[model samples]
Target: MVSEEEGKILIRLARKSIESYVKNKSLIDIPEDTPETLKENMGVFTTLNKNGMLRGCIGYPEPIKPLINALVEVAVSAAVNDPRFPPVSESELDDLEIEVSVLTKPELIEVEKPEQYMDKIKIGEDGLIIERGPYRGLLLPQVAVELGWNVEEFLYNTCVKAGLTADCWLFKDVKIYKFSSQIFNE
Candidate 1:
């Protein structure tokens, strides 16, 4: 778990990012001492809804930058770039709730069948990363319960998204890993 001080800083930085972007449509610079530990294979998600149905959800599967920057970028992306929804109007800002989930680093495994995967994965604890050839994809731990998918099924779907066969993860040089998160929402 992150310390209370760290949590305050993170929340402050995130709210600042939101306010700035929503007001002047500008990006916020990442703060220094933003915790290097939080910047590894982490992700930031913004979950928006209207009348209890999902409106937009967007984020990074890997930490491409500092956590604050990643959060701001992905929040804006979810608000405006989610292909599934129209751009979020300013009026909807109050109704939108941002939920952040930082992921753990995925661990690659060698297995011969789907059954081999079941024993190694924890449905609600381990986030997954899968890579094949030049393609890669990820699923946060929460996705399992949300979709009611078993570990093997989740892996297969992730692989398919990367344009690989369901069993591609079993192939040579294919990579996989798992990570946990410190999740928060508002």
Candidate 2:
């Protein structure tokens, strides 16, 4: 688990990273006293919100890089690279709130039928990932809680996010995975 102080450091780092990117400045250096947990590889998502609405959200679902590095990369990418929104301008930095979610490795759910997957999910606690062939999409755990969606709606939305039909989870080749996250916000 990340200590409160470490979580604060991460949130600050995310904000600084986005600021530097928007201003075309050099990347902020990670502090020498950073904790080992931050140095370890971890999956992370950086979420940008303006006035309580989502501005951009992007993440790595696997622990492919150091936590600090992943945080910086995703923070900048969510600010500028998310296709759902235009690049965030320097002027918008002050109004933007940064949220960082450090994810646990996703575990695939084994089920004979797609409908069985619903029994394994906890609405406010487990993030969902749906995959089939080349298509993949994920919904963070907090999404369902925040949107007031039931289990079926969460699954349907995740499928839609994957560019599949809303009922794609019922298909034979579909795979479902679940994971939790430690979410920190500014």
Candidate 3:
């Protein structure tokens, strides 16, 4: 788990990365002596909100890089590369609020039936991932909390997000995974 001070440092790093990108400046460099925790591989998401509305949110669901590096990449991507929204402008930076979520490694949950999976989920705590063959969708833990979704609603939405039918979880082939996160916001 990241300490409060470490979380603050991460938030700062994310902001600096986004700011640097918007201004066309060099990316902020992580010092060689960075904390070991920051250097560890981790999955991270950066969420950008403007005036209480979502601006852009993007993340890596799997741990592919060091935490600090992932933060920088995802921060800039959330600010500029999110396909759902146009690129954020420099003027809009001041109005934007950044939130970072550091994820625990996802654990696959074995179940014989979809309804059985529902019983395993803990609302507002475990983030859900539904996968089958080539399709996959993930909802971060905070998503359920922020949207006030119960387990059923969360499952439905996750399947929908994966481009599957609302009841896709009922299928026997669907794979379910759950993970928790440490969320920090600016």
Candidate 4:
């Protein structure tokens, strides 16, 4: 488990990194105080919003660099690369709320019955990734209540997002994984 102090440091460093990037209009190199040793040890996601509606959400599934460095990349990516929405505008920054979720390693599951998620899954705690037939979709763990979606409904929506049949994940080739995260809004 990460200590509270460590979490706070990451939060501070992450926010600073984003602010620097925005100010420079380019990705800034990770600062010396930012922990580079833990880059590959953490995965990060960024969710941006305005007036409580989603603006952009983007992340990496596995730690590619220390958490702070990853945060810089993700925060910028969420602002610019979320295909679902246009790039975040400077005006939106003042109105925008940012959220950071640091994910744990995902657990793969074999589902004989898809409905099993109701009992086997714990919303708000388990980030989910569903894959089948070259299609895949992922929802950070906190997505459940925000969308009011049950497991099947959640999976179905994910399928739609990935351009697959809702039931496509029922196939033997399908893969499922659940992970947890530490989430906070800025």
Q: Specify the highest-TM-score model's number.
A: 2
- lDDT tens digits, residue span 1-186, model 1: 455566556556655666577777888877766786555445566555666667677777655665666777777777678887887777776776666665544456657764577788888888778876688877778877789998878888778767788888666677777777777755
Off by over 4 Å in 2: none
- Sorted on lDDT, best first, the list reads 2, 3, 4, 1
Q: Regarding lDDT, does 1 or 3 come out ahead?
A: 3
Estimate candidate 2's alpha-carbon lDDT, on a 0 to 1 scale.
0.92
Deviating ranges (above 4 Å) for candidate 3? none
CA displacement after TM-score superposition, residue 110 of candidate 4 (Å): 2.2
Best-fitting candidate, measured by lDDT?
A: 2
What is the TM-score (0 to 1) of candidate 1?
A: 0.75
What number of clashing residue pairs does each candidate have, in the order they appear? 7, 0, 0, 4
lDDT of 1 at 179: 74
User: Compared to the true structure, candidate 4 yields what TM-score?
Assistant: 0.86
TM per candidate comes to 0.75, 0.97, 0.96, 0.86
Candidate 2 clashes: the total is 0
Full-model lDDT for every candidate: 0.70, 0.92, 0.90, 0.74
Candidate 3, residues 25-103: lDDT per residue as tens digits? 5677886767899888999999999999999999988889999899999999999999999999999999999999999
Error of 3 at 159 (Å): 0.6
Give the Cα error of residue 96 in candidate 3, in Å.
0.7
Per residue, candidate 4 scores C-alpha lDDT tens digits across 48-70 of 88898998888887766667777
